[model samples]
Target: MTESLNSALGTISSVVWGPFVLIPLLLGTGLYLTIRLGGLQFRTLGRAMRHAFFDGDEEGNAGDISNYQALTTALAATVGTGNIVGVATAISVGGPGALFWIWVTGLLGMASKYTEAYLGVRYRVVDDKGNQLGGPQIYLKRGIPGGFGAALAFLFALFASIAAFGIGNLTQGNSVAAGMKDTFGVDPWITGVIMFVFTGATLLGGIQAIGKITSAFVPLMIVIYVVGGLVVLFLLADRLPAAIALIFTDAFTGTAAQGGFVGATIMLAVRFGVARGIFSNESGMGSAAIAAAAAKTSHPVRQGLVSMTQTFIDTLIVVSITGLTIVASGVWDQGADTAATMTSAAFTTALPGQWGGTIVSVSLIFFAFSTIIGWAYYGERSLVSLVGQWSSLPYRLLFTVVVFLSAITEIETAWLFSDIANGLMALPNLIGLLIMSGLVARETRAYLKFDPKLKKPKLSVEEFTAAQMPNWK
Candidate 1:
């Protein structure tokens, strides 16, 4: 039964993430959003960075978490194994040139992420008890019209909930356990039990718990990984230029099999690069929107702009550094099948002794932990959307169990489950983004036109809620 199930999942995954559909859909939607937003991702990058870091919540802000906490929570989910393992996989299968396409994905992904954040916040609602509720579900209902919106919203919630089990819970646990086992020779089951306990303890406290922990953990882990990568880059400074040239040339001309590399066509480079890049940044996935909606901001567009920086930090900065270090160290072809170990080898080679390998292993543990922390919230919110607040406790418990199982189980099947679930989740969410793209453009333009000095909202939260209440037009 297990073998058959794995076979079915593999077939489904290939179909779901096929080069003809999912890739083109992701890339095209991002490009469309970039044009729709008039390239605000590039133009307002400075403002976005300021808002992400320096801006504080409005006095008596009406939300669960501050904007920074929300952004960090979202970042925690995004800046996970995808940065380390996913980058190595992309380069190994697609060659060094895959880095260029991945960069392209990030650049365009900024617009899609921005729009996802914007719509999430714009349609968000605060309960009488002050609980915040929103995401692709709310926006699809508020921004899109009629039955189509309602169905798509529900589909998104369903897929997100399912996807969370694999992408957020099981896959992460497996990665964490694998990293720990590889580094310390510990039993994977022991690591699994520890993660089960830790993640459950954190999940039991709810969104506030997630927000605070991720806020602290996310930045620290990112710094650790980035500083380690930078050390490797500095050590291989002379090889950096050649590594870069190889990436660009391979992107278009194809990479010839050299060393352990099996060669990759240009098509393979674009496919894996775009796929892994999406997995890394999660720009159009709509998961970030769930966090963005919880931010304490008077204007939806503010949080939207602020949240877009996640892609910049996750893909452009963190993932890029990892990719560069792997390339510069000339380790891309080594350990071809074991991408994570391949990445670790690069760092180990560049830094003296076993310190680099240790760092990568430690970083993975933290990254996977934080990703689970963030995804716990997403899963909770998804259940809440489906079955209301009553579902939160049961969902968290179930999520924790899956995390434990994921750690102890073989990870090969976990990868297929995660891919299929992710593709399904992205499908409905991306459709919604494209359908309501006009709203994103209109809302963004209106927000940008507002005077920076006039931060006061014309309508209070209550007034704003009253004005934008859902109506089927």
Candidate 2:
């Protein structure tokens, strides 16, 4: 029965994430949003980065966390196994060209990321507890107006709740456990217990705690991993140009089988690239919008721009470093078993002694732990949207328990479950974004026209909310 269920899920996931369905829809929606927004992501990325990393939240803004904290919280959720393991998987299966497609997905995904954040803030509402709650649940239901909108919102929350466990929790926990076991011989149960304690402790404080913790460590973890990757790239400096050429050339012409790598077709490159790209950054998945909605900002457009930078950092920088290092180190052709360990393997080969594996193991553990806390919020919020505030604590407890279980167990099926749930989560969000794109474009253009710097919006949060979303209160 278990095998049959797993097989069933595999079939469903394949179809859900097929080239004709989600791949094109995700790409098409992002393309449409990019066109509608007038290439806003490209134009304002500098300003967006400023807001995300340097700027403080403007006074009188309505939300729980600062822009930087929110960005990091969102970053905490995104920059996990995907950056390391997922990128390696893409290159190994799809070849060097897959990295090129991942870039395409990230580039286009930036627009979709901006749109979801914009709407998340625009349609956000305060709960009875005075908590700032929002996401696709709030936006899809309220932004679209009526039964259809409510249904879409429900589906998003449903899938997100499931994905929070699979993609956000189980997959991360399993990765961390597996990495530790391989590198340090730590028992999976021990890792699971430690994660459970830390996860439960952090989650007790909710988003505020999550925001603070993620902000402190997310940047540090990223820098450590990136620096290690660069060292590997530097050691393989002579092969840099050729590795880059393979990324572009193979993207057009399928990679021929070499070493232990089975040759990949151009279509295979596009498929894994797009799939893992979305998995890594989660630009259109609507999960990040939940964090965006909690950001302290005067206008939706301001936070939206800040939020999109998460994708830029996740895929364009972190994933790029991992992919390039693997390709440059010449270890990506070592067959399917190497996907999870490819990045570390590359680093191990380049860096002397045990430094390479240790760096990756530590980063993977922290990245996975951060993801657990981050997704705990997403899942709890999702439940709150469905069953109201009463479910939040129980859901968090349940989520924590599951984290331990996932760590101690073999969970290959969890990846399949996560892929399907993540894809399904994106569907309603992409559709809603397409439907409400006009609003996203109009508001964005208007906001950018007035305060391109986001230092001060023409109207404060109150005035802006009242003017644009009069019925929100």
Candidate 3:
């Protein structure tokens, strides 16, 4: 039965993520939105980052966390193994050219991320307990004209919450523990116990605590990892041109067999690049929207602009660093899993021996831990949206247990299942974004036209109503 289930899930994942379905769907939607919103993401990215951090609007906002906190929390979840292991995997399987496609995905995804966060804030609702609830689910049910849309959104949330436990919880734990075991000889059980305690402590404190922790850790981890990657890149300065050339050339004509590389086709490069890019940035996946919903922002567009930065940071900057380093090191052609191990190997090759490995191992541990905390909040929010706040304690408990299990389990199947769930979760979100595209565009236009000195339009109730449609309660 397990085998059959795995096989079924694989088929579903392939079908859902196939180019014919996902490629055009994702890129097409982003293109349409970019035009409709008058390239809001591109024009306002800098403005968005400024508002997210420096705007005093957070002081009087009605949400649970600040825009910066929310962005960091979302970034904590996104800039994880995907930036490292996922990028390596894409380049290993898809060739250097995969990096180009990854760039494309992240660039287009910025617009999609903007749309998700805009609707997340605009359509958010307050539960009976007065706790805020929102995301694509809220908008789909409320924003669309029919009950069917709401149902689809609810289903997306359900699967996404379950997926958080696997992808966000166990898989991360597995990767971290495994890396520690391999690099430091730390016992997996020991690592798992430590992680359980750490996660339990943070998760018990809820979103505010999670946000605080992620906000502190996310920046630290990014700096450490990026610095380490830069050191290696600088060392391989001579190979930089060739590495970049391979990414573009191999993306089209296929990688020729050289060194340990088995060569790769353009299709493989595009496939892996797009897949890993989506996994890394998660622009339309709805998970980031969950975090964005909690941001204290009177203007949805402001938060949306902040949200776009997550993609830029995750895929465009960080993942690109990892990919280029691997290509420059020429380790990707080795028959490796394209994971942290591969990235470590690449770094080791580029740098002075074990120093590279040590940096990657330590960085992965921090990145993975932050991801666990962020995803725990995401899952908790989804559960609260589905089963209410009373179940939050039990949900946290279950989530902790899953995190422990992830440490000891071989997570390939779990990873595959999580991928399917992610794809499934995206479907409803994309539907909602498409249906409400005009509303997002209107919000952008109105916000741009309004003089900041005047009374901000009365949007709270409308936003709440849009979020709490017939599908929610």
Candidate 4:
């Protein structure tokens, strides 16, 4: 029965994430937003980086955390198993061309990220406890207007709440467990218990706590992984040119059977590449918008810019390093047993014995654990939107339980199921982004006109919202 269910999920995942469905919708929505926004993500990335890493909170800004904290929190959720195992899986199943498609999602999806983040903050509301509420749940309903919007909002919330367990919970825990077992021979059940405790402790403090923890460690973890990957790349410098060519060539033409890599069609490459890319950075999934909505900024555009940097960091830099290292190290064509350990194996091949694997195992542990904390907040918020604030604790507790359960289990099925849920979660949010692209573009233009460099805006957020978005909820 389990095998049967896994097969069914694989088929459904293919259809949901295939060329005809989410591929076009995701890419088209992103392309449309990029044009509508006049490539704001490209033009403002430097300033966005400054805001995300250097800027402090605006005085009197209505938010629970600084923009930097929010950015890191979102990064915590994103820069995890996807960057490690997901990239490897993409290359293993889809070929190196998958990395090229991943790049496409990162570049184009930046616009989608900006639009969703802008709308998330634009339509955000203050809950009864004074916590901020946002993301597709708030934006789709309030931004769209009428029953259709409400339905979309509900579906987004439902999918997000469930996706939290799959992508955010199971896949993350399973990866950490798998990496540890592969590298250190640690038992999965032991890892599960320890992770359960750590995740639950972090969840008890809520988003504010998660933000503080992620902010402090997320950058450090990323730096460690990037530096380790760079060492591997340097060792494999001779293979760099050929690897780059293969990625581009295979992107258009399918990869033929080679070594342990059975083979992949052009369609498979595109599908897995896009799927893993979306899984890695989550540019269009709208999950990161939930974190962006909590940022302290004077304008939605400011927060949106900072928020979009999450994708740039996750995919453009981090995912690139992992994928390049895997391809260049010549471990990408290894069989399924290497999928979870591909990055580690690549690093091990370049560095002295045990050191490379140790770094990767430690990084995976931190990455996956941080993701669990970050996504717990997303799940909590989704439940709050569906039920109320009353569901927060219960949801957190349940999420912790699932982290343990997922760690001790096999995750091939989990990955496929999570991909489907992620696509479903993105569907309503993507529609909302496309439908509201004009409004997002207009608001962004209006804001940039007043403060192009992210300096002090001429108008206060209240004044700007009241004057420009008169009917804004």
Candidate 5:
């Protein structure tokens, strides 16, 4: 029954994420947002980076977490196997050409990400206790008009909660167990138990705990992975240009079957590349907004600018490094490489020893572990949005239990199931973004222009709503 269900999910997953619908909807949303924002992501790249990396913590801020912490937490959720395994899979299945489309998707996604973060802050609910809760859920209902908003918000929360389990807990826990067992020969159950303990310990501390750990965890992990990947790229500097040329050329002309690749058309390259790219950076999914909404900052645009860096770093940098390393290592065409295998091979081949595989294994564990914790928080938010604040503990308990179970048992079907859920979550989010693009644009313009009255402190959710959408209540 489980096997049959998995097969059914795989088919449905393909339909849900098919190039005909999902790709265009995603890319089209990004394109629409870019036009609405007037290429704001590109223009404000420096400001966004400054806010994301170098800016000191905001004092007397209104939100829950620091801007940097929120960005890191979001990064923690996004920068997992998707960067390593997912990139390798895309290149392997879709060919080198896929990388180009992936790049395009990430580039367009920057605008979409910015809009999401903007709305996250703009529509955030600050309870009497000053707890900020926001995402597509709040904005979908609050930002979009009428009953459609409520329906869409509920739909988004439903899918997001479901996604939190598959993509968040089970898949991440499974990957950690797989990586640990492969590298250190530990039992999966042992790994599962240890992880569950660690997760339980941290969950007791709540978002602040998550923010602190992820802020520290995300930067170090990314730097370590990038530096290691750079060494491999430097080793293969001679082939870098050719590898890149093939990617560009084949993006349009299609890649012929070489080695075990079995070739790929432009359509296949676009489909897998875009899907995996979205999966990697999560630009259009609105999951990042849940984290961004909690950022401690006065200006929605300020936090929005900071949140934009998540996409730039996750895809343009981290995923690119992984993709390039594999291409440079000449491993994508060297027969079949499974989720973890191609990446492991690329690094091992570049380093010419077991060290590369060891690094991949170690990094994979850290990556997946961070994702497990980060998504646990996201799932908790989704549950709270659906039920109430009382659901937090139960959801956390459920998430950790799944963590243990997934560690002990493989969750192959959850991967495809998560894809379907992810696609569903994005639909409502993209719709909200479309409806609120004008408000985002207005807030951005008002903020950037240094509107004298608006510059001193952040607007409350209600004030923000009034200022941006004058017609709305």
Candidate 6:
């Protein structure tokens, strides 16, 4: 039965994620949004960064976290093994052209992520307990008509929550533990246990605590990883121009077999690039919107701008670093998993010796650990959205348990399950986004026209329902 189920899922995943579907779905939505929003993501990126860190609207808004913290939390989940492992996997399988596709996805995805965050904040409602609740589900059910929207929203949240456990937690935790064991010779079980304990402790403090931790951890780890890659690239400075040229050249012309490389077609490059790009940044997956909903801001566009930056940092900066390192070191030709370990090997070979391996291993541990923390909150919110606030306790317990279980699982199965759930989670959310895109455009236009320094628009009596407010301050 499990095998049959897996087979069925694999077929569905192929259909859903195929270029015919996913490419148009993702790129089309982003293009539509970019046109509708008048290229707001590009125009406001610097301003968004300013508001995100320095001049944030930290007036104790009724949300679980501040805008910066929320962005960091989402970034924590995003800038994970995907940046390290997923990029290597793409280049290894899809060839250099895959890196180009990843860049394209990130560029367009910035607009998609901005739209998701905008709608997330605009349609957000406060629960009976004054807690804020918003995401694709909220926008779909509330903004759209009839029982169909409600059903789809419910389904999206349910599957997305499950996916949170798979892609968001288990896959990440497993990678971290495995990396630690491979490099440091620590027992996988021991690493898992330690992760479980640390996750439990942080989650106990709730979203605020989660946000604080991610804010510190995400930026620091990204700097460390990027700097490490820069060092590698600098060591092989002469090859830098050649590596860049190869990404575009091999993208079209088939890469001839070199060393252990089996060569690749343009199709393979597109496939692996789009797949790993989605895995890394997750712009349209609707997961980041879960965290975006919690940002403390008066205008949805403010948070949306900040949200867009996550993709920029994830793909444009971090993943690019990984790609350059692998290409420069010529490690992609080595027939290997081309994920975390391969990237680690590139770093090790590029650097002096054990130092490169040590840096990557440590960085992966921190990046993946923070991802687990961030995704735990996403799961918690999704569970709360589905069941109730009371369900959070048992949900956390289950999440912690699964983190341990994931550590010992086969990497192939772990990645497969993560892929399936990620696809499932994306469907409903994308539907919601498509349906409510008009509203997203409307809200974005209004926010852009209205000055951020101005007082917030007064909520109409109809809009002042308890469902429209947030629980936290």
What are the lDDT scores of the predictions, listed in order? 0.84, 0.89, 0.80, 0.90, 0.84, 0.80
Worst 10 residues of 5 by lDDT: 451-460
TM-score of each: 0.94, 0.96, 0.92, 0.98, 0.94, 0.92
Give the TM-score (vs. native) of candidate 5. Answer: 0.94
Off by over 4 Å in 6: 1-10, 336-338, 452-473
Superior candidate under TM-score, 1 versus 4: 4
Which lDDT tens digits does candidate 2 get at residues 1-473?
76897899989977987888999999999999999999988999998898777776665568899888889999999999989988888898899999999999999999999999988887888987898899999999988888999999999999898889988898899889889998999999999999999999999999999999999999999999988888888998999999999899999999999999999999889888998899999988999999989988767888899889999999999999999998988999998677878888989988899999999999999888888899999988988999899999999999999999988655557777888889999999989999999988987777667676777643664575567656653
Model 3 ranges off by over 4 Å: 1-9, 257-262, 451-473
Between candidates 1 and 5, name the one with more favorable lDDT: 1
- Write the candidate numbers in order of decreasing lDDT: 4, 2, 1, 5, 3, 6
Total clashes, candidate 3? 2
The per-candidate count of clashes, in order, stands at: 0, 0, 2, 0, 0, 4
The predictions' CA RMSDs to the true structure, in order, are: 2.6, 1.6, 3.6, 1.4, 2.9, 3.5
lDDT of 1 by residue, 324-375 (tens): 9999889897635677577788899878888988999999889888888788
Report the poorest 10 consecutive residues by lDDT, candidate 6. 460-469
Residue pairs with colliding backbones in model 3 are 94-269, 123-467
The CA lDDT at 74 in model 6 is 91
User: Could you give me the TM-score of model 1 versus the true structure?
Assistant: 0.94
Error of 5 at 367 (Å): 1.2
**Local distance difference test, candidate 6:** 0.80
- Model 2: what TM-score? 0.96
Candidate 3 to native Cα RMSD, angstroms: 3.6
